[model samples]
Target: MTLEYLDYTIVFLSLGSSIAIGVYYGFFNKSKTSEDYMFGNRQMKVLPIAISLVASQINPLTIIGFPSEIFVFGITFGFHFIGMIFVVLILIYLIIPIFYENNITNCYDYIEKRFDRRTMIFLKTLFFILGYLYIPVYSYISSQALSFVTTGINVHLINTIVCSICVMYTMLGGLKAVVWTDVLQNFVMFFALLFITYIGVTEVGSFKETFSRASDIGIFEVNTNLDITSKNTIWNCFLSGVLLFTCLIGFNQSCVQRIVSLPTIKDSRKAIILFFIGFIITVSIVCILAVVMAAFFNDCDPLKSGEINQSDNILSYFVQKLSINTRGIQGMYMACVVCASLSTISANINSLSCTLYKDCIKPFIPNSKNNNLIPKIIALLSGVFLICSGFVVEILNSTAIQIITTSLNLVFSTYASTFMLGFLAPRIHSRAMFLSNIVGFIVILGVIVKGQFFSGRVQYEPIEKTFSTDC
Candidate 1:
């Protein structure tokens, strides 16, 4: 069930290609200023930016997260797409125009102009908190995937190496390198899903057979019960989806950074539209793939049978089960997982560096203004922070999707009302908004602390997934 040399070769080639991209951009397409390093001088290609957005949105945590989630919770996540549509609309017509009109590169930078340094710093702190909580989860997931590929491998070593590779290219190549490598890694993601799906469906007999098995598992049912207290109901998913997607997609620095990277407002809007389209397609495929995995594992549950350590690693377990007949499939899946992590890791690290320099460091030192090397060095340092923080994820008991949703929920509670009121309600006093922001952050931070340590992890009841060892 182990990967052969062919698989290792494929994985290494992917890793090597990503580094090569960094070298090319770092040397040939060098950024002359910090602005160019961050946003490609606002003259970057539109399509690559669009694809990179998709990659960052659907990184490795998601590649495995969706299937694990679907295997247990069904398609509740899909209902969130409805709210996401509206979020995209707001980003395109309403929010993006403000950033574009103001010539704002760092999203937090806009806060300083509209309000004050204090308000900007408050929002910036929330952004940093979100990044620190979630980015490491992605790195943890990537390392777990590699460890699954080669059983008994050192998890920390895998995490360190893979994260280092991603950070190296990010620091060397800048945003252009990140985007182009994303284009490459995104392709790897698509191919991995395709290969697994085709094989899985074939093994399950046919597409029709697979769907029937998924239905038999009861995950195919759409719970339309309209109750806020309910977990998997369509009604709950819709409301939570809108709220959460707004925080994750609308306000997240990673998404905003990509949108601002393009030149014109028109281009930025077009890229957002393209990103929406790409996301829907990619998510549709992931959902379908999850169903396929569910169908294949319908009878003998990997979790119940002890075939995988966790549901998050189920996709890797399934791949290993299929490895007897395949040689290089493990490598392909590994590459896909690695690519997913790299896309988000690099994007957020890049975004993190910008916020650190612009909001955190530069304001204090005023002398570091407009310096390119400082940002690059900050990016490199952020990479170290990402690696160290990522290891902390080992202590969490929930799956990737659960962890992400929980963190985003807390973050939304902290910054959403304040952030929106800041831009949408110009007549509102900045002091009032800042006060609300402080109260919201303190309340949510308390909830997070109590839930994680004192009380218990706050979560809704989930549908019972019928898992058994006996077929």
Candidate 2:
């Protein structure tokens, strides 16, 4: 069969498998109670939680766009993960203390307890916004992957279809099913990474050959200067990455819900440790894969050739190259891409649903503690609304995507300072906590906006963006 036929076959096969899995999860593992739905009945094992963490973090962007970053930038960007290690440490020592101390159901619960009713409501509302808004980035990634393996399909159209599939399953099964499905996706993820790594190494000859090629292209660099102005520098990585990841992992409802899955706080701690190990391994594998792709395609630059304008297109380009050389590998490659996209989107939907139920709808529902239907209804509605929001994003010509992505990133970032002030600083009144968070949120948002909009005028080169304009 021709490569085009094989590509079509792959998408068809993937869609079939996705539907089958969703149906099985929906029917067999339906949630019987709020605890069962929200926290997997609080009986989660360490391995599943670990796998879920990896699944949550390894979005299609990380799989597709990240390797592209490594290819275009260099191994220096590995420092981002390095700082992530320290961020996990911060979570363990700093953030987890409050979580364990308070026996919190949602991360935002801490804000309500430490601050006031207004603060709690506001913060939870903020997270609801953050969660719903972030859906499009996953949609964008899925659409891009679909485009890679299909012909004559619009990317936005593919995104909406994929988003609908995800919302349908998540709305049907709730969080437990999502976690169970994540375990399977995590394995698919590992297999996918290993497959790409194998193909890349074989294409480049060997490990030594791959490293030699990467070195020839100047892909490895270890710089010690801690300058915020220098992108990917160790110092800037320490500052920005610590802040970024603390919010991403510690504060994110997606990550929080997973950690709270275990039976006890101690088990939660164990899951966090396992998550750190899995996170390191998963990130390291992706980095190695990125290097492999760079070496294998050392002479090709699609942007330079005007084949594509964005770094995100690199994975499709590489996959097409592999399809030309092998039989059916392209099919497996596309399956991996779809699995990555589906897993992350599934987790996001699950978490978003949980937040809406616990923080938004539950408070209003009379005797919500006794009536579990409220949570289920809220979860279902949240998924439906977010899918609509995804379509709205598609219509707005990309602004919806930007707002969703940036709002979540900034909201998650404040999680670090919010949790720190609440847990670490003693004698902080609810008034103080409220005032500090408001002040900090405004200040941080201003800084980020100024940096993004007036970056050319200020000429302040952040460590992560130092090399962004080089090409």
Candidate 3:
């Protein structure tokens, strides 16, 4: 189960290449203007940017979390893909044009143009805070994956190492480096999943056998319950997916920056379409891998057998067991996890830097010659913050996926709503928007409090357990 020297070499080379790419862009091909550094001179090709968009969106959370979700729940989670298609269509037709037409570096720039500086500042502050909180979860997930591969190393040290590498590259390369590395990482991620799925299915005899075993245990059950509180119902999946994508792809700064980095609106739209294709394929593969893992362990469930400490670790456990004598497979899997984490962390750092310098720091130091240095410094500071926050995550000892999902919901629940108000309801006065935002914020807070403290009225009953002995 331990990683061999060759396995370690494979992972090191993978990560090392990412840093090298960052160094190449950050130093040798230095971006002269803020535009070049922040938006890649607006000359990036659609294909790489498309791949980057997909890569940045698929992080450790999706890589690890999605499989864990499918394992614990069922195939009903796949219905979210339907909702994703709906959201991406909206983005291509309605959202990207506005941002591209405005030629904005930060997504919040449209807020200032549409409403007033006060409203823009409020949303910018929220983005900055939420982004800061979110980056740590990425680090925590990367460190967790690193722990599986390098069991001798401490998780805290792993976090520091992973975050340091991400910061170094992001500080050096800027947006171009992030995009190019994402192209590479996305391939690694796909290959890893393909390899794991192939091995898992082969071990289970065939794809037919795999599904037959899964179906025997009712893994194909779709949640048709109408109850709003039901976690994975079709309605819940569709609505939550719509909201999640509206916030993430429609309004999130990290996503918007990548979309706008392309040369033209047409290219950005194309990138969105390409991204959707890649997203669906990759997500479907991961979900199938989840079912495959379930089939592989149908007889000896890892959670029931206490072979793994957490559901999130089930994939890692499966990888280790499958890679007992298989040399580079484990390293490849670890590389996949690292690539997923690094792409996301780097994108967030770059986007957050862009947000801070453009919205917060530049106003004070207007027309300064050293304005370019602001983003670099902020990128470095962001790395340190992520590392520190990662330690806090470790201290909390929470599941990375749950913490991330909850945090995103709390931080971004009203973001898409506010953006829609600005974009679609232009005649709405800034005062009215401001007041509405305040009231909406209060209502969201009340709902959160109610869910946390006054949830006695609704209770979740566990699904009946039925394990299959036909592995």
Candidate 4:
């Protein structure tokens, strides 16, 4: 179990391949224009773009945090996948065609046309703020997981080194490089998940034992709570799942960039559907993995026994303990979490730089356009912000999933509701749209300030209790 030569080799190859992909694109497939740099000149294919879309969102949180979320909360969390249907419908029929037909580079461009410049700016501000909050937390989560493997390294050092590599590929290769890199990272992520799950389930004894233990312990208990403020309710998951994904696909500029990068509306719609299928498959693995974890530790319950006090540390502990008999998986697990962080950071900074150029810079600096250097410069500058902000992430006490989902859900929900109104209710006036955005912002901010800050650490009671007889 100490990460052996094979382990380190796997980790290095995973990281190295990501950087090499960037180098290939950076040198062989240089971006010739702003569109080329930002959207691959809208010439990209459906599958890679779809995979990149999935990979962009699948970070350490998805791999590390999601299982813990399901194990602790309940299997009802899977109900959120139901919301993807609404997400795809809106994107395919209501959203993508507009962008494709108009040849819009930025999703917010339509906002400016339909509403006003100020509304577009407001959404852009929220987008950058989200990137700032999310990328660092993701980096910190990766460092924490890797710390379990590479025990000698400082957390901050791990984050900086990995992120620097991500920035190098992203800056040189542009959108094309990031997409291809994501395609590679996505397979690694899935395989890692399945590999760990198989090892864990086998340790627990058998497939039937794992499922039986989970059921007997009520890890499969259903949550019926309909209150929106209540955490992890079937109602809330279903609703937030819909809104969160819709916003992610519908309005979030990073994801929107993926949709707009395709050559035609037909290709864009194909990507959207494929992204949904990919998303369903990923979540299915996480759900099964969570149940498997519950069964593997059924007798000794790591969280309750105080062996792994933190919820997020449970997987790391499981991997560490099981590695004694199995061997070599330590590096694969390391690659999984590290690549998760890399995919997330690369995609966000890449599109976020474009967000800055299109919304923030081009509007004010008239000469910024038709300049390939400016986009790369903006991407480089964003990378600095990405790394520096990560240093602040370790200070938070909550689990990575809680921190990310709370802030992201609040913002995305607001943006989802506020922005969708533009297309759904086209007759609405500019002033009305602006006021709607302000109200949505105020409301979401209130929820965060009151629910997250002032309240004594809010905890949602699990639907079913987990008992460890041996412990």
TM-score per candidate, chains pooled: 0.93, 0.88, 0.95, 0.95
Give lDDT tens digits, candidate 2, residues 184-284.
77777777678878887888899999987777766776667665666456666556666767787888878888887777777777777887788788888
Q: lDDT tens string, model 4, 293-406?
A: 888777777777777777888778778887888767888899999889988988888888877776667778766546677677877887777678776677676667767888
Give the count of colliding residue pairs in each prediction. 0, 3, 1, 0
Greater lDDT among 1 and 3 belongs to 3
Say which prediction, candidate 2 or candidate 4, comes out ahead on lDDT. Answer: 4
**Candidate 1 — worst ten consecutive residues by lDDT sum?**
454-463
Q: List per-prediction Cα lDDT, in the order shown.
A: 0.80, 0.71, 0.83, 0.83
Off by over 4 Å in 3: 369-371, 454-465, 469-471
Local accuracy of candidate 1 as per-residue lDDT tens digits, 136-247: 8888888887897798888888888988998888988888898999999988888888888788888889999999888888777788876654667788777777777676
Q: Model 2 has how many clashing residue pairs? A: 3
How close is each model in CA RMSD to the real structure?
2.4, 3.9, 2.0, 1.8
Model 1: residues with Cα > 4 Å off, grouped in runs: 362-370, 396-402, 448-471
Looking at model 2, report the run of 10 residues with the lowest lDDT sum.
460-469
Q: How does candidate 4 score on lDDT?
A: 0.83
